[model samples]
Target: MNGPGGYFGGCLTALDDCLRGTFGYTAPATLLWRDASTAREHLSRALTAEGRPYDLFAGTLQVLAEGGMHVTLA
Candidate 1:
């Protein structure tokens, strides 16, 4: 999988940056997957709290999925 740092990798980096800025930390990809709902919830809350549109994150996830990324939420 093309991870953060490449052309197709910025999504994870973006997520990490967002999370770090909002929650003071970053989560491992595996852990994020393991607790997908909680992760999304935190992201949603943070984005809303910060006055950013939550659709940005949702759109990124959609793009990732369309790009063949396997992100199991359950």
Candidate 2:
């Protein structure tokens, strides 16, 4: 939650509010903010030597999350 609402006032609550309003249900959602720059740096030097752009990966995940199968990020 932002400002004075603490955890209850932030994005998760916002999501819950939205879902409750739109679908007549409220549920928790896991939020994952991956450290992509660090990931890319390590990936470039170690594993693949080439890594997919952060946006591509994030967008794919976004699509899956919005697919309405009750998937939650971790």
Candidate 3:
């Protein structure tokens, strides 16, 4: 992933930078560049067991808001 419109996935460095500028959480505790199988497992963990999306979305919104970032949802 690169910056605004990366093809594979969102650039986590960009996300971390966004969070740093906003809520003071930076650099990341973990960054996983997964192969396809591991990536599926990761998604499963987030969507079900950890429920990461529900927890993360609002905080992400806040970070983006604080950073004055506006994205068009298309």
Candidate 4:
């Protein structure tokens, strides 16, 4: 997996490579990404508003896929 190679390749493979190298996944993880640029503008300015300088996510999702459990949200 991770294919032992280049960029943005084999998502599941990367996870497999991670599990193999680490010997196992000690904790559950969620793997996701966005190429979106400036997309956050539509949301409340409060996210960056405080100058608190941190990221906040306000909801949740429960997903069962590929015999694995995943929870996804902002």
Candidate 5:
């Protein structure tokens, strides 16, 4: 989606904005995510500000789905 060395921020909000065409790509797109299992495993252990367990992988998928992106986990 982005050019080489292009950055669109690291937070979910930024990801949502990028999916909305804020950076360039349009919504309702398709994404082939390779090695998603590893990402999921790591993100699943993430924590929130209040030290609560946060499923970042699920949250990220939610954001992507909300942005109209169909993700295929490989």
Candidate 6:
């Protein structure tokens, strides 16, 4: 995790930047997401800027995968 006000980004573009080592960590990383199911349930109800329904959990997983990161949901 980032330290001292470090931000991992709130949107996909920022997440991509962080995954690229722009924020410090690089890709091909492993993420162990505890209570991911609960988080997913909440995040999946999010909406986009256009007021369209979006599956943030799935989207995040896709982005992480695209960045070569292995995600383990617990």
Where model 2 places Cα greater than 4 Å from the true spot, the runs are: 1-54, 69-74
Candidate 4 weakest lDDT stretch, 10 residues = 55-64
> On residues 1-74, what C-alpha lDDT tens digit does candidate 1 reach at each position?
23343323345556544444543332333222556677577665445446776654476566455444456675
User: Each prediction's TM-score against the native?
Assistant: 0.41, 0.22, 0.31, 0.23, 0.83, 0.82
* Candidate 3 colliding pairs, count: 0
On the 0 to 100 scale, the lDDT of residue 48 in model 1 is: 49
lDDT tens per residue, model 4, 1-74: 23223332233444444444554443354545242223243322334445754222211111113324353423
- On residues 1-74, what C-alpha lDDT tens digit does candidate 5 reach at each position? 24442665588888778777667667667878889999998999899989999999999999989989899999
The lDDT values for all models are 0.49, 0.41, 0.43, 0.34, 0.82, 0.82
Question: Rank by lDDT, descending?
Answer: 5, 6, 1, 3, 2, 4
Candidate 2 Cα deviation (angstroms), residue 69: 4.1
Cα lDDT of candidate 6 equals 0.82
| Two-way lDDT contest, 1 vs 6, winner | 6
Rank the models by TM-score, top first: 5, 6, 1, 3, 4, 2
Prediction 2 global C-alpha lDDT: 0.41
Q: Give the worst 10-residue stretch by lDDT in candidate 6.
A: 1-10
Task: Predict model 4's lDDT versus the native.
Answer: 0.34
Model 4 TM-score, all chains together = 0.23
Cα distance off (Å), candidate 6, residue 62: 0.7
Off by over 4 Å in 1: 1-32, 46-50
Which pairs clash in the backbone of model 5?
A: none
Tens digit per residue, CA lDDT, model 2, 1-74 = 23222333223335445444554433445445357566444534432227533443443344435533244333
In the range 1-74, model 6's lDDT, one tens digit per residue, is: 33343777768888877777666676667888889989898999999999999999999999889988899999
Point out the higher-scoring one by TM-score: 1 or 5: 5
Candidate 6 segments whose C-alpha is farther than 4 A from its true place: 1-6
Q: Identify the runs in model 4 with alpha carbons over 4 angstroms from their true place.
A: 1-11, 20-24, 30-69
- Give me the displacement of residue 40 in model 2, in angstroms: 7.8
User: In candidate 1, residue 60 scores what lDDT?
Assistant: 55
